[model samples]
Target chain A: MLCYRAWVETRWRFLICLTVMLLPSVLYFHELGIFPMQHWTSDPHYAYGLLFGTHLPSIGIWTFAAVFLGLGGLLRERAVGTSTLTLTLPVSRAHVVGTRVGVGASETVALALAPWIVNSSISLFERTPFSRAQAGWCVLLLVGGGLVYFACAVLVSSVVEGEYTAAALMFALVYGIGYLADHVSGFSALNLYPLMSGTRYLDRNTNLFPGPMPWLGILASSSASALMLLAAVTITRRRDF
Target chain B: MIAAPAIQTSSLSKYYGRTSAVQNLDLVVEANRITGFLGRNGAGKSTTIKMLLGLIRPTGGDGTILGRQITNPELNRQARAHIAYVAEDKPLYRYLTVAQTVRFAAAFYRDWRCDVAGKLLREYELPLNRRVKALSKGMRTKLALLLALARKPELLILDEPTEGLDPVMIEHLMQTIVARAAEGTAVFFSSHQIAEVERVADQVCILDRGCLVLDRSLDSLRESFRRVDMVFPVDVVEREFQLPGVERIRANRRQMSVLTSANAEGVIERARAFNAVSLEVAPVGLRDVFLAMVNGLESAIGKEN
Candidate 1:
C-alpha cells in the first residue's frame, strides 16, 4: 500500500511523462511511412537511432517528474502537513526513503521503455523488423544514464524546501552540469543529454544495434545514481522530521 | 510488582540554537493510567513528545519509552511499533480516503486491532470513502483518534487531542481515552484544556516555559494543595509566612491570600499565629492549582529577565 500510495501520488505525472515520451515515436512512424518501406529498404538502424534520439524530450520531462515524485517524502511532507504522521510510523526513515526511491526509479525505467514499446508495436504491425537486442540495449543505456538525473533530482529535492524551487534547482543543476560536460573534453562521459538520448554513443557508429554497448558509461552513470540515493538516505536519516 | 515507567526522561533538553525549548526536564509517567500533559502555548509539550518518539533528536540528554531508548534509531523504531502517536495537527494523507488511511496505518503495526478499528469507523460515523481532505475538522480528529486507538498499542501519545473539537466531541474523545486507560494502555495526551485533563487524567504534569513545574496525581493535588485566605486585624510581614510548603503569598493590606501545595495544616497554623481575624481554607481545584503554578512560574521568570 505504501507503493500504492506513492503511485497514486505520482500516477498523474507518470502518465504525462509516458505520453510525452511515446508521442514523437508514434508520430514519426506515421509521417515517414517507414512501415511500408520495410526493414531492408528503410534502414532500421538509422530509424532506431532517430526514434530513440527523440528520447531527449522524454528525458527532460522525466527529470522534472523524478524530482516531483521525490519531492513529497519526509523533507517536504512538512508542506503537506503529513510529516509527523509519516515520521512517526514504525518504519525507519531509510525504509521510507527507500520505498519512495524505489517507486520513482521504477517509474523512470518505465518511461525509458516507453519509446521502445511504441517502436516495437509499430514494427510488429508493419512486419518491419526491429532488433530486440538493440531496443533492450537502448533501454538499458537510457535508464542507466537517465537515472543519474533522476537520482540527482532526488538529491536536490531532498535538500531544497519548496516544490518549484526544488524543480528549478534540479533543472539548473542538470543543465549546468550538462553545459560543462559538453564543453570540457574530459567530462564527455558525464553528459546526460546525449547519454540519455543514445546520440553521443551513436556518433561513433550509426549502428547502435549489434554494436558494442556503452558498458563503461552505463557502469559509471549507474554508480553515480547509487551514490546520490545513498546521500539522500543519509540526509533523511539525520533530518529531524 | 512495579513495572517500569511507560516513559522516563532525565535532563532531556532540546535547544534550537540559542533558544532552549525544553531544559533539564526529569519526567516519569506511570503505566496503566491516563497522564495529562498540560502547558500553555509553546510550553514544550509537543517538543517533549516529539523527542520521546524520536521524531526529533534531542540536543542533550536521553529518554526511554516503554523501556526502549529513544536516542537510538533502531531502538526507537522498535518502541514506535508498540506506540501509537497522534500528532498535534492530527496529520493524515490527504490523498487517501478514510478507509485507505486506516488500512495504510494498520499495515505498519503488528498489534493493529481490526475490531476496534471497525467499531471506531462506525462510532465516529466517518465516511470510509471520503478522502481525508474532504472530511470536516471534527471528522478528521475522530479519524486520527480512530487510527491511534485501533492500534491497541502499549503506549498511546496524543498531542492536543481535543483542540478545535466541539464540547460533545471533546467529551466523546475523553471517554475513549478513559476507556483506553481502563484497558491498561498508558495514554499520555497534551492539552491546554484543564477541565478535560482534570476529568480523565489520573496523573497531571504541568509544563511552563519548557520546564515541568508540577507533577502529581490529580487526587493528590486536590487533597494536598490549598488556598488559605485570611483577614487579619493588622498587616502581616510576607516573610513571616514563608513556610516550606508556601507556593505563593500575596498581601493586600489586612487581607492575605496564601497558596500551598503541601503542609496545608502548617500554613493554617502560621496564619493563626499572625492573629488572623477571619480565616478560610479552601480546597484548590485543578484549574486553580494549574493557574497558580503556571502563573507563579511566569512571574519568577519575569523577574529574572
Candidate 2:
C-alpha cells in the first residue's frame, strides 16, 4: 500500500524520464548513419558510435531524473505540510524511507534498462544484429555505477528541507564532484562519469570493453551509494521533523 | 487487570536550543475519556502532540501511548496502529480525490470504519471525485478529519480541531468527538473553543508557556472555581486579599474582584471581614478561569481577547 502511494507520487517523474531516454534511443538507432548526432564523416565508425551510443546522452538526463526522484520524503513533506499525515501512519519511519527508496531505485533501474531493452529488441530484427552481451554489460555498468547519484540525492533531500534547495544543492554537489574528478588529474580510476558511461573500459578499435566489464568500478560506486543511503536513514530516523 | 492510560508522559519536554516548547510536562490522560487540551498560541500544544506521535523526537524526558514507548521507533509505530490523529492544519494529498484519499487512509489501518466513512461523506457533503487541492478549505478540513474519525482507534488526538470550522460544522464535530469517546476512544484534543471543550471534555488541561498550568475534571472546575465581587467603604489595596486559593485580584475604587480556583468560601469569609457593603459571588466559567489563569501571568495575554 505504501508502495502504491510512493508509486503514485513518483510515476509521472519516472515516466517522463523513461520517455526522455527512450525516444532518443530509437532516434539514434534507426538514423541513416551512426554519429549523426553531430557531423557525419565519409568513413563512418559504426561500431565505435554504437559503443558510446544512445546511452551517452541518457547518462546525464537519468542522473538528474534520479536526483529528482529522490528529492521527496518526510523532510519535503514537512515543507508541504503533509509530514504529520505521513509520519503518523502505523508504519516505521524506516519503512516509509525504505519504500520510497525502493520505488525510486526500481524506477531508476527501469529507466536505465528501458532504452537498452528497446534498442536490443530492435537489434534482434536488424540485418546485422548487435551483441546482446554488450547491451547487458552496458546496463550492468549503468545501474551499478550510477546509483550513487540517486542515493546522494536521497541523502541531500533527507538532510535539506525544500525541493528547490535540495535540487540546487544536489546539482552543485554533483557538478563539483564532476569538476574535481576531471581537473584533479589522478582520480580517473574512481571517476563516476567514466564508470557510468563505461568509457574507461571501452576500446576504440573494435568496441568498448575489449577485456572484461569494470566490476571494481561498479563495486566502488555501489558502495558509495550504500553508505550515502545509510547516512540518510540515520539522519531521518533521528530528525526532529 | 487495569488498562493503561491512553496517553501518559513523564517530564516530557521539547527544547529548541535556548527556547523551550514543552517544559517538564507530566501529563496523564485517562482511558475512555475526552480530555480537552487548551493552550494559548505557542503554548507547545502542537509540539507536545508531535512528540507523542513520534513525528519529532523529544529533546528531554520520555512518554508513551497505549503503554508503548514513544522514543522507541518500533513501539511508537505499534502504538500508532491504534491511534488516530488530525493535525491542526488538516493536511491531505492535493493530487488524490476524496475517494482516493479515503482509500489511501483505509490501506493503513485494519480497524477503518467504512460505515463512518460513508456517513461522513454524506454528512460533510464531500464529493468523492473532487481532488483535495480542488476542494474548499472547509471541505478539505472535513476530509482530513474524516480520515481519523473513520478509524476505531484506542486513542484519538486532534490539535485545534475547530479552528477554521463554521458554527454548524463545529457543532457536528463536537458531537462526533463525544460519540467517539462514548464508543471507548480516549480522545485528547486541543482547541481554543472554550465553549466546545466545556460541552464535550471530561478533563480539561490548559498549557501556558510550555507548562501544564491547569489540569482538572470539568465537574471539579465547575464546582470549585469562583469569582467574588465585593464593595468596601474603605480604600483597599490588592494585597488585602492574598488568600491561599486566591489566584487573581482586580480592584477599582471601592469594587474588588477576586478569582479563586478553590476555597471560595474562605474568600467570602475574608471579604466579609473587610466590611463590604455588598458582595456578589458567581461560579467562574471556563473562559473566566482561562483568563484568570493566563492573566495572572501576563496582562498582555488578556488584552488579546
What tier of docking accuracy does candidate 1 attain?
Answer: high
TM-score of each: 0.93, 0.93
Residue-level lDDT of model 2, residues B14-127, one tens digit each, is 999999999999999999999999988999999999999998889899998899999999999999999999999998988888999999999999999999899989999999
Which parts of model 2 are misplaced by more than 4 Å? A32-52, A185-190, B252-254, B297-305
Residue B53 Cα positional deviation in candidate 2, in Å, after optimal superposition: 0.7
RMSD of 2: 3.3
lDDT per residue for candidate 1 within B143-238, as digits (tens), equals 998899887889999998887678887888888898889888999999888888999999999998989999999999988888888888998877
Q: How far out, in Å, is residue B2 in model 1?
A: 1.5
Deviation in angstroms for A182 in model 2?
Answer: 2.1
Best by lDDT: 2
